[model samples]
Target: MSVTAAKGFTAAGIVAGIKENGNPDLALVVNTGPRRAAAGVFTSNRVKAAPVLWSEQVLKSGRLSAVILNSGGANACTGPKGFQDTHATAEKVADVLGVGAGEVAVCSTGLIGVLLPMDKLLPGVETAVGQLSEHGGEKAAIAIKTTDTVHKTSVVTKDGWTVGGMAKGAGMLAPGLATMLVVLTTDADLDSDALDKALRAATKVTFDRVDSDGCMSTNDTVLLLASGASEVTPEYAEFAEAVRAVCDDLGQQLIRDAEGASKDIKVEVINAATEDDAVEVGRSIARNNLLKCAIHGEDPNWGRVLSAIGTTSAAFEPDRLNVAINGVWVCKNGGVGEDRDKVDMRYREVHIVADLAAGSETATIWTNDLTADYVHENSAYSS
Candidate 1:
């Protein structure tokens, strides 16, 4: 259940004075042996965090030995100074670990437009490096949380290899890889090219499919490190599959813990003319506040679902559409099928299946129900 007990890497977390509450806000994960090949994905937001910019450059070499992450101060919108802070943080870690700065990726989350507390962060990095251990994954997970109630981590073992990951995010979560931070480590002997390929594929299906608040974060990054410490190389197919399972698990946890969420909604769009169309349909519906609010209110408003899909370019004739909620047919051929009152919404999980009646392509996206709490939590978040 602990992050370190999962496998592949050693981690440590310490209070870095980044948060006013003095919670542990700095974390480090080191691939202790056999240097690992690395691959990373970052936010598509044109405005990126300083750590994201730094890590994006480091990942180009396809080699990584460690990662340093902090919460409570997202080093974004601080201009050149933010970049300097990220570089300094990585350099401090590299100096202690005896590795090049490029071998360490940096990530940060929390309030944007502010500077990081470098005075405390630099020393905190030293303490984290000293506490590294295989069982320190949970602590590292804990250290990176902003509004999360609990740390999110997942481990999957396949034959001779193990893949594990830690994630943190409770708000500002949407597609293009949620406004979250994720670090995945594996003992599989994979080259950087393969690692990159696998990570992209996995993210496309998992992280890229979740939209909780529709607001993207300034700091979002997913880094994959392979230690090859196990000395057991599996087929690339097998390794990628294992990595995907871990990502899927973490993605689900992110949605379940979404800020102010009362229910986790899974939106499935089927029969689209193409995969892109399927995803477009799914995302439009996932990001619709009206539909989300309807679901939260236990209102089987199939009309809202249709209206959301109509806003997309999924090539579906309005009259040919069909909708179902929690396995109960609510609409058929764009008209009401069963009594809306027959559906139950008391459960924590909700499913919406939309049939485009086009081609065979399909996609699924995970989102959360909208509630008054969501508005309250975000409206005054920065205050």
Candidate 2:
């Protein structure tokens, strides 16, 4: 059901003519709630989008009644006018929902540096609001797609409570805070503090581990809202686990649907002295373009892995390092160890293991192979 799968929430998606192609480009998600508790994370890029700046301020109140998102324009680098557009959008949502403008959060995604068609969007807001329905979650998810080929949604249920989420990203998929726009809703009895705690814990290992193209978006946003309609107060740990499960699933889906990617690579860093060390090593391997090209070519290249690790500050002994590809140990003690000819590379998924031999901590990062399709898709992206 996506965001509207949770109790006390309704959503709708409509064609706003913001996209010249006439696709449904605007989505509205509302909290018909007994409680309006929420938390969010945005892109760490210094060049933030106008909508992100507005939503970041709205979320400081630690409550949100509704969120409006559009996929036809990024509204970044458009100066003060862009922020005004976002502000006006929130005011429009507030007017219709009978709430203060401060209670509404807004998100926009698409080509950067372009102004949105407010003549089309402002009126579309009223139309989308009239069509709000709990079953409209899937439509909202579909409306967020840009270069993505598929819509992403995930749901997990527990006793008397459930968490549902929707995400969209096909490029600029890197980790800082979030790589794309994601909306998560839960029916549990949670306050803003509880949600902030749960969301930070979830995105740490999930969204933060995905590094598809190593490019961070200026408008990335991940928001979690709670309606408290289930009337069930779940344990903090249990609720956090459920949130993590949904984020993890959505992150994996983003990687699988990454733009022009032929192989999905999973890099596992083991035997690290600390979790941070493991994560750094894994992220380094995941972002290595040379290693990604090797995986796409079905070539077992242990040298590239060592080169990536050497650039990181993670704890490791050069001579004691080990590397494995698809269950075949290709390098041992920082040199050639296993037969590269025995490694399998026919599958779309490739697994690479890096052993630091420093301790027992571990972490994994997901990435996709670079290809000609990726270059072409981005080169002609704005046309």
Backbone clashes in model 2, listed as residue pairs: none
What would the per-residue lDDT of candidate 1 be over residues 19-67, giving only the tens digit for each residue? 9998999999998758578999998889998999999999999999889
Q: For each candidate in the order shown, give its overall lDDT on alpha carbons.
A: 0.87, 0.90
Model 1 deviation from the true structure expressed as Cα RMSD, one decimal place: 1.9
Q: Across residues 242-310, which tens digit of lDDT does each residue of candidate 2 receive?
A: 999999999999999998899989999999999999999998898888988878888888999999999
Single out the weakest 10-residue window by summed lDDT for candidate 2: 170-179
Summed backbone clashes in each candidate are: 0, 0
What shift in Å separates residue 235 of candidate 2 from its native position after superposition? 0.4
TM-score of every model versus the real structure: 0.97, 0.98
